[model samples]
Target chain A: MEQSTESDICTDPVIRDQWYPLRALAELPEGATHHTRLLGVPVSCGVTRGRPWARTESAPGDGGTGALPVIDTYGYLWTSLGEPPPGVFEIPEYTEPDRRSMNAGSFIVATSAPRAVENFLDMGHFPYVHTGYLGIEPHTEVNPYDVEIIDGEIWATRCEFFQPMAAATATGGQMSKYTYRVPSPFAVMLYKSSPVDPERRDVIALLLQPMGHEQVVAHNFLCLLDDVNSDAEIKRFQQIIFAQDKPILENQIPRRLPLDPRAETPIRADHTSIVYRRHLRELGVNYGVVPA
Target chain B: MIRLYDWELSVNCYKQRLLMALLEVPYEIVPVDFFPGWEHKSPEFGRINPLGHIPVLDDDGFIVRDANAILVYLATRYDPTRTWYPVADPELLALTAQWLMFSEGTTNTASAARLHDGLGYDFDVEACRAGAHRLFRVLDEHLWFGEREGRHWVCPSPHPTIADLAIFPDVALSEEGGISRVDYPAVRRWMDRVRHLPGFVGMPGISPPLATSPPSVG
Candidate 1:
């Protein structure tokens, strides 16, 4: 099926065993439960003693046995459906003393989680989809970037692009270097040259929560070492850039990602996408993907 | 000489520019950085208009503040056909005024939702989207009946009035605010009509019909 009409939960152990970020801690107040869905299963999250907790919708509210494993790390409240992960993945930059870390809101995209993650990894769209911000026309050519799987995580290094207005603190056009990492199937992070300090790079992560087989909530988190640009300015930059991708994501032909070989034509620029699909296939992630 | 305090992305500001363009009125833009900069809200801009909003027009120091009001002034002063404002016909004038009021509802909801999404304005986006849909439903039914009765514009007239220009930007750019116009067939057709209007102009998000003409060819 091109698009799942009803809730299609991926019951694969590979998927359920992995943790998904349900919501950011900023979304929940101290004593209120925010009802949400995870991989088409109803889930609720509430904060307790400054620590967030999540429970499946069918579980008892008084903290009976049904409370799913919750981990408060990387600026979000992460939970799992089946066997819990040993620990959340590492992001040493998140703990940097001078970094300004914040939860940059969640966006509801009407597409599969993989499709959202792939869009995060795609840079060819920057010159068009994010015109005047990330990149612009005539400077649309994607230079050679290196992509490979390192330590079970896919990395695309040496990626660079020209951005007229790269970030909220951008002064002028600068050739920004980018390093993309796919730590989990549903998460992608990019380390780009800081607008002020080119020697240092900024971190922006897109954590996908598959509400259904064809619906995903993209939680944006930013950990940056910036002496300028207030919280509102940084958040606004992220919101505008992500909002521009919403129409393009929902209007995709397949709605879900196609992983079968030869399903899509890719160029040298799409090396990251090609490797990402192969990585997902090897992991047997059939939830929001079409593998024919 | 006419001067417009314009923001390139503001739909309300586009309403004025579109009307002036259609009326063949020459105007220069005094650009205001509405987003990121908030130049419109600055003390320097407040002296121009105490309201601290954009799309303000000055015709040799005779100022017009609101987008709809500027549309009325432009059409009444420039267009010789008198069909845009129809000041002579009380019934048509009243009808045009009614739809202009309808444009206010769309501007507040549809365009406001776009602001919340793009510029980080704090608004209840769900309510903004729902309110826009309800107004669009009313507009679609009206336009559908109008099309059946051989009327194309929002008012019952042979040609478009300021009402069409006033509401065009909000409905055209509704998707930017996550308000889909797929269900409103008549509204889409009417928007197509407005896009093909003589001397029609478009701002950032609102573009004219494709496969019909070429100017800003990439």
Candidate 2:
């Protein structure tokens, strides 16, 4: 991947035009209007006639000034600041009849959205940060994973981890198989082995809305095939995992993720992260990225 | 009829607007130019509130000043459901009052920092930011354990009280003042729950909650 300077990434217009999920469609209350910031633009979103809509605000106090097209798919309300791409990314697992869809709710992080997405792709912090659940001291090794860019999307397959508690309903240790994908600059998806049914993998997606270059609102979506745990339990489990990650993301120096190879030393465990950053750089995402 | 001396961006004034919205009370806002004009400090406005605050409340000629005091008055008089204040419940009432005091600390620190940054108020920005973090840490830990016990709000009630509204604007808008809430996940989740309440509204910094679909059942 060609390395780009900080200026190139900030001026990249493509990132602004891509569809970003603002919130979960089911989570938005009826007749309720929500005010939020997307791509540094103040926006108001609400459902009208059973359809979700979003528009940018011209003034701070006034309501939405211009209408922006909205799409509801994969259980989220998606919008874009500029012209949106053709359609939202599709998750095949969402169609499974037995899988229960869950919204883990939204979290506002002080760090840039790209950094937050990078953190979601990182498994090396599982043992230390997530403690006994996702990882532990003795099982800290992140085995070699296969990373490839397919049709412009970054994918990491064959990733594996030893988890003491793989899921909220988990009671014992297990080896979890994983596959990570970055379908968009600010969005990431992880498919991992389900504790209830190892044959059926659980799909978790982190849909991020960049409020500014240094701020983001992360919306987590979980598609799980579990009969033992309630929907609330699943949402809580994801919240706990992300909550453990929030502090580390916030404290990183420079706030934005560095794209230059010399910015920060990467160990072998960061292979996926390295590839993800390179892909972001290649896509000219510089809004929240810094140079070495 | 209730009249609120209001400013659009003032977090203190937002406290009253939020509570009144949650209670579904009707009120008219007497707009006070708190920004470039500094209308609240003007002699004419001082006649309404000698303290020169923009959130003074007048209910049919009865006057109330200060954000928390107005919350108590509004809830006590307007919330016929009695859940917002819960004066009948002694333990919950005390807890509510305690958090109301806690909200004052947040206002002095978090909201104060916002004043310095957004309105160019002269204050020790770093000191205010640090103070806000200290308070947020305490509240985050408190709310984290509260979730474990199934206590969603500050006062241990299933329904949110005035205390949540009191502290929400400052905490929600802390980012504008350079205070990061990334460490306080429990507080962040509580903000979502409060936003999900019926009749909830958003100001400049506060965002409304998404529509929640009922949990999928077997």
Candidate 3:
């Protein structure tokens, strides 16, 4: 086994140029200001008369009113440290009129953003970490999922699992179908079966802000077409799930995730994670990920 | 009228500022150069707080020295709702006091590490970081189970007490000190809940919640 060193991984420039969620749209109230650091740059976001704007202080721009591009979409404030490619990723499900949009809140993880993204992509831990909720012991089998890289995006389809408590309003066990998509290095979204209507799926997006080499803030946005549970109950359900994964992710040695196959052993269940790592490697995202 | 000896970047000062904002109490700031200026060490400033600290709160000539102490005093006196301090309920009050002390541990470790990194303060940075992580792990577990039990704050109260304000600044700013909250997802969620509080204010490095309704995804 080869050990990955800090020198083996360097900050990749490609990650900074892409847009990531800075704050939820609801977080930036009219006339209110928010300060955060994106890809190690100071950013201040504010709303003016129902319009939200973000300015990177280090960038060549005037104070507050500068040449910074800010967009409000999918219930989040999206911005980039560098010139973003055109626009943010589009989620057609967001256009659905009946979907209730919720920002589950932002989380700060000590590990690299890549590690957090990979964890979000993994379903093997569901049985142990989210026991009796997302999964249970007897239902540990993970059917092979189809993965593909289309137009610089990683997609995992046909993923299914038996979830004990699929949602806050869930009554009993049910098979949940899921499709995971990695639109950007630090952003991942999942279209999973809705607890209320199994035929319908809910869109959950985890947008991460890479604070540094080993630090990230994740913004969780959920678009669900559910008629039962209140928004608060839904938020709490997601919060509990994320809380279980935090300790496991942080305790992983090397802080930065390793892309090298030899760095850590993987089973068939990590197919989505493997493909996701390959895509990251193709993009040269070495900032928070060790090189192969 | 209340007056606070404050520093813009000090997490301790932020605790007082945050609580005052939450309580909607009007207080004037007596700015102290806590960093390179070291105004807190000056004789004139020392009289206000002999301990050479910022966030010394004075309400009608009654002086409160420490950050946690100031939170208790302001919440007890200024919070007309009587929910911030929770003195009416003995069990809840005890838990608040316990967590307030926990905040002191974070100050010594997390805030101490920040002082060493940001202001060139002399201290064992590694030890401070280690101490902070230990404290954060405990807090994360407590909060994780608290969420399970349907309790949001440190105590069982539906509303947040001063303990939440007392510990939040240090935890939120732990990254500057090289302490990561990544392992503490429950703590991270609690941070958002704290930021969402009405009239919540933030200091440098501390972010306030967005002004719209929190997202409700199932």
Among these predicted structures, which one has the highest TM-score? 1
Better of 2 and 3 by DockQ: 3
TM-score of chain A of each: 0.94, 0.93, 0.91
Candidate 3 lDDT by residue in tens digits, B1-218: 89888766678888888888877789987666453345688898888888887779889899989888888888878888889998889998999999999999999999998776544356888999999999999998998898888888888899998899889989998876778788999998888888888788865466566568592211
State, as a TM-score between 0 and 1, how close model 2 is to the true structure. Answer: 0.60
Residue A103: error of model 1 in Å? 2.6
In terms of docking quality, how is candidate 2 classified? incorrect
**Candidate 2 backbone collisions, by pair:** A9-A286, A26-B211, A26-B213, A27-B210, A27-B211, A27-B212, A28-B210, A28-B211, A29-B211, A127-A135
Candidate 3: deviation at residue B106, Å?
A: 7.5
- CA lDDT of B208 in candidate 2? 64
State in Å the error of residue B73, model 1.
Answer: 13
Q: What is the TM-score of chain B alone in each candidate?
A: 0.95, 0.95, 0.95
Q: For candidate 1, report its TM-score.
A: 0.73
Order of the predicted models by DockQ, top scorer first: 1, 3, 2
Candidate 3 error regions (>4 Å): A1-13, A59-66, B1-218
Give model 2's TM-score for chain A to 2 decimal places.
0.93
Per-candidate DockQ vs. reference: 0.12, 0.03, 0.03
Give the number of the best model, judged by DockQ.
1
